[model samples]
Target: MVRIKFFLFSILFLCSSEILAQTENIKGKIIASGDLVGIHIINKTAGKFTITNDFGEFEIPAKLNDTILVSGVEYVPKEIIVDDISMQAKQLVINLEVNLNVLDEVVVGKILTGDLMTDIENSEAKREMNFYDLGIPGYTGPRKTQSERRLYEAQSGGGLVPLNPLINWITGRTKRLKEQIEREEIGIAINEAKAKYAKVIFEDEPFSETLQNEYFYFCGDDPSFKTLSDVGNELVMLQFLKEKLEAFKIHLEKK
Candidate 1:
């Protein structure tokens, strides 16, 4: 009886540890103009999610290096990592760039009267210059921040991260900051991947939302996963997903 009771206690302790791991809450605010309410804030690593109130402020459970995804319809999606500084501070502040759709500038090739009928008339048809005409491939990928580009190059094994010799022993500060940025990039990339590949990848074996969230967290833990995601190479990511799917299945079996 004593042995069985000790075993149960150990199980409870382990469970408690995991619960605590995801409960280190971080207070934050969205530093963007316009509507901030209903902005979704998700702790992707922990599978925890929340939304901002009317004040553009949110509190979500997160730990150091955990990825936090911030998304809204009106603003460009952003990811933040819970680095040591953010964890230690009272709150984290994120500045999000609002997504803008600017139409191409139009100039009248002919004089036009301020009349509705004339405006409704079809304009001249001119072939716009494009990459096809130039024989150059077009890039339609998401824009990368400076840190993100560095991280991508690092992952590709050709990046040289230069640091001042004086600050060489950075008390793990540099590493922690880098991790925060890395996690942010990874979270955004993973979000895009889930949207694009979720249906196709899980056709054989569908998973519930909770299970899927856990599976994504497992994938983000992989070192090379972020690199492939950054490149946005469809074939490479598909293969990566297949490999991770098998690994995830094996993990579930072990559990």
Candidate 2:
């Protein structure tokens, strides 16, 4: 009887320990422009998911075979599956590529505009310097108007058919007229990202805070970002796209 009781106690203790053991966690960071921008961790079976802090770090209970979705403003969303590679919960980096053509319009005549610049500036505007503040590479001019000036200056080396001059002769810098094709390409890239993801962050109403906290780091303040504050749900994404395009319009408008 003593032996049987001891055996039963041992079995119960083992069972309890198994039941109380903590689950393993998944950890990782989201990357953009070659730096951590967001954090993503999920344990759907446990009904838990946590976003990292501003520094882009997070840890959450997880297990083998779980799935995690990582996303951010203007980036491609990625789904991660746990395996031997992910089971260790190693620091993971995710890169999101921008979507190029959402509207199916490949027309290259669109021009860059100041309004687009203003809008893009607003998206993550804050009080800190950003990659842009470092100034665009291979382009030089006054700081305030530097980006503005780069918009119109013909390619300095003049090897690739002089994009600015070709655009100048074609579009002639009118508001209604489509401007430079190069500027349009940049505008489309920016607008496409904004149209697809801005609503996911700004107008979703339920998930606005999730977007602001999890994805966008405060870069600096711009009227463009502020313009999105009161935007309605149906139009929020469109507004973001339009604003970005307006910024692109600057390429044709300047000089």
Candidate 3:
């Protein structure tokens, strides 16, 4: 029995070590002007991802031949294939090209007058043709909020182009947008938990408003809080909060 246990431990250790050795973090920077923060960096081959900091720097694990794709809202998507040299150096510097909107020559039309009344009377203000005009069915889902829309814009769009990038990158706008959305979710979860468990949980250990706020913030700080809150299951959230309460009580006792 002892021999079997030892052998099993050895196997586990070897597997752990192998996983640890499989990848090393490759630091990289996104070279661009404007908001470089929150650019998405994905390792296509390794299935890893990270975001650029305010300085347009990011790190993601990769080995040789692993593809890194970088995308931005106003930049063209570029792919980097990890080479032996880059792997050895464990760093990358990437340049980005702006995807500028090149407008076609505008057709000469009636110029607008300075007077609003004159412009309204003489000029046409017809709306542009849209999907509805073409009789095409469009998205009927709920409209996305500002943060959601910004997140979508950051992660998507570079127009039709070659996307052989070993990895895909997103603009920095995504990072900030996600945080905003996350805060909203956490706020909702905290409010719901407070309403549901208020007196019941604290009856055994009464806490002042300050302590209560701290306790809830403590719960919010847990990484798993976002997952639980997103799930939005009453029973699951309740159990998770109860577990957090015990942990919080223990933490307070230590202090």
Candidate 4:
């Protein structure tokens, strides 16, 4: 029984050593501009994978002459072959290149209905005449002459108290307050639009939390975003988002 146990121990030791000899711990650093976090380091031969940390450093199991693939969202994929020198050094450094994907040029043409000024004049002719556009028979227009206004105010007892200026002040303040409220409501609507568009863009992708946040901000920073949000038409906003998404995809592919 003692002899059998010794033989088994020897076989186990040999197997462990063989396994260790076949696999190498490859430490690597990814060098690039911007954040290098979450870059994937894969050893296809060994079927092992790892990712870069915040510092752009990673470690993976590889074997001599094994092919290792390094890739990131904003970079071109790179391949490295492990060799004796790398194994001796126990470390490697990879520099990734920006993969710029160019999109096809688009040509847009204007649709003309008629001469712009003529069309405006014709449309104006069709519009109903308001009090200001067409003066009343007895009154001059929406704004009466100063003398006429004062005479009317005097007859109504409004001129005695001089409440016209005070009423004007109150009306101006009310107008300003309404405008402020409208601006705040528009701001809230814009934020909601950004969130909704972000969900639509990345709904199908499996992204890390950090990446999701980054992408959400990226969508918000799109040039057309503010304009589309201000327009406030869902169909138009959706179309604009789709176009922006295509551009963003190309940016990511090329970066």
Candidate 5:
């Protein structure tokens, strides 16, 4: 019985050693044509996963001959097999390809009819009307224009009391001031969105200063971005931004 117990223990030790020998911690970098940040590096057999950092570098626990699956937004998934050389070096570099879907070409052109009089009448009717038709305030009726209102305000008090210039403050509608405030608010909101999501969505490798600026503008104009930014959920925002970045990348490529 004692001999049997000793044999079982020896077998268990050998199995454990084999398992440990097969598993290794591999450090690697993800290489791609564009940004590599946030790419997923997954060890299929080991059931381990990691994400690339700003530098596209990652470390994951894997084993020899294990399959590593790499994926990212708008990038085609890649499968890499761990080899003896990679295991010995404790390092690997995986490359990913961008998957761009081709679209059908569309041609748009004007169809001109032979009737000159009818065309002239139609063109005249399509001409833009005055501000009244556009629903602009004070442009349709007897109401004063914005400039007239500001002139009146200036004549009245100039935003200060005559007796004491610092005592009484007059505040009224100033179109220029209102426009400036609106611009400033928009700028603040855009910066906040950028601070929250830009780094993660647009990795450090391919996103340069100009590209970053363009992304900011693109997000500012996107309705979904506005909604996500207001909700303030980091995870959802990250996912949404990733989708938007993919679309933005496609747009850039087309340009």
Candidate 6:
């Protein structure tokens, strides 16, 4: 009889304790700009793991003292503890840092088969040889009025235009053009090169500078290292550019 009573008391105590434990829902947003993003979430007590959605939002059921960790590609991982004792639920906004050192490096171009021009013509799986050079923003074409026409001719051969002068005209800017070829052919070379080394490094100021360089490239202007030697003050039309970079990163990763 004593054993049965003790067992019943023990069960009742456990059930009551469980009911008394604090439980709360955690909600948060993860905003990752400027790079391909991957995320992982961990529940401290449960030792279970999950990931953020495409928009980088996460929700998990947690106890008052439980910890939640968030991580993404090219963005720093963050750990947050649940403290909803006084509050019912919690909301958090996480901003990840960018990785700059890796961004500064130049990755070599992927090789191609056809003749130099033919190779350039059929480079990307999407066959976006010309599209890649389209200026950034709403502008998606050649810097020169004749650039598009020449590209068309090169592709069709029927509009056979002289190649020597065209090559000469675009020569000094080979590095910039090459970067486009890689983007069109495979994807953003930089993102692919450092898939695992994902972290944001540049602060606001430096980030602005880097973006300005991207803008220059977007418009088909090769703002070489020398050209940017003393350049200051970066102008970024953030509204569209932000979306463009994120979309572009995902596109490359998919390829």
TM-score of each: 0.37, 0.30, 0.38, 0.34, 0.35, 0.30
* Distance from true location, Cα of 228 in model 2, Å: 33
What is the overall TM-score of model 3 with all chains considered together?
0.38
Instruction: Supply every candidate's count of residue pairs whose N, Cα or C atoms clash at under 3 angstroms.
Output: 0, 18, 8, 3, 0, 12
lDDT of 4 by residue, 44-145 (tens): 455445568889998876667777777676776677989878887889999987757577545354321222222222221121123455465554323554
The segments of candidate 5 whose C-alpha lies over 4 angstroms from its true place after superposition are 1-21, 103-255
Question: lDDT of candidate 6?
Answer: 0.44
Model 1 CA deviation exceeding 4 Å by range: 1-171
- The whole-model C-alpha lDDT of candidate 1 against the native structure comes to 0.66
Question: lDDT by residue for model 2 over 131-191, one digit each (tens)?
Answer: 3666756542325333444544532327556665666555654222333443443444444
lDDT of 5 by residue, 171-234 (tens): 4344454555445545666787677556555554488878887877776677676666555444
Tens digit of per-residue lDDT, candidate 1, span 227-247: 877654444565577789899
What candidate 3 gets wrong by more than 4 Å, as runs, is 1-143, 162-171
Better of 5 and 6 by TM-score: 5
Model 2 error, position 183 (Å) = 61
Residue 239 C-alpha lDDT in model 2 = 42
Q: CA lDDT of each candidate?
A: 0.66, 0.45, 0.67, 0.60, 0.63, 0.44
| lDDT tens digits, residue span 1-255, model 6 | 999999999999998666445455667677667443336555545343344666777666556656565544455555676665422536667676654444554546643221222222222212112223555445433354344344444434223686654664467444454444534433232332123112211112233555544433442222331222112111112112333455545654676
Best by TM-score: 3
Flag regions of model 4 displaced more than 4 Å.
Answer: 1-21, 104-255
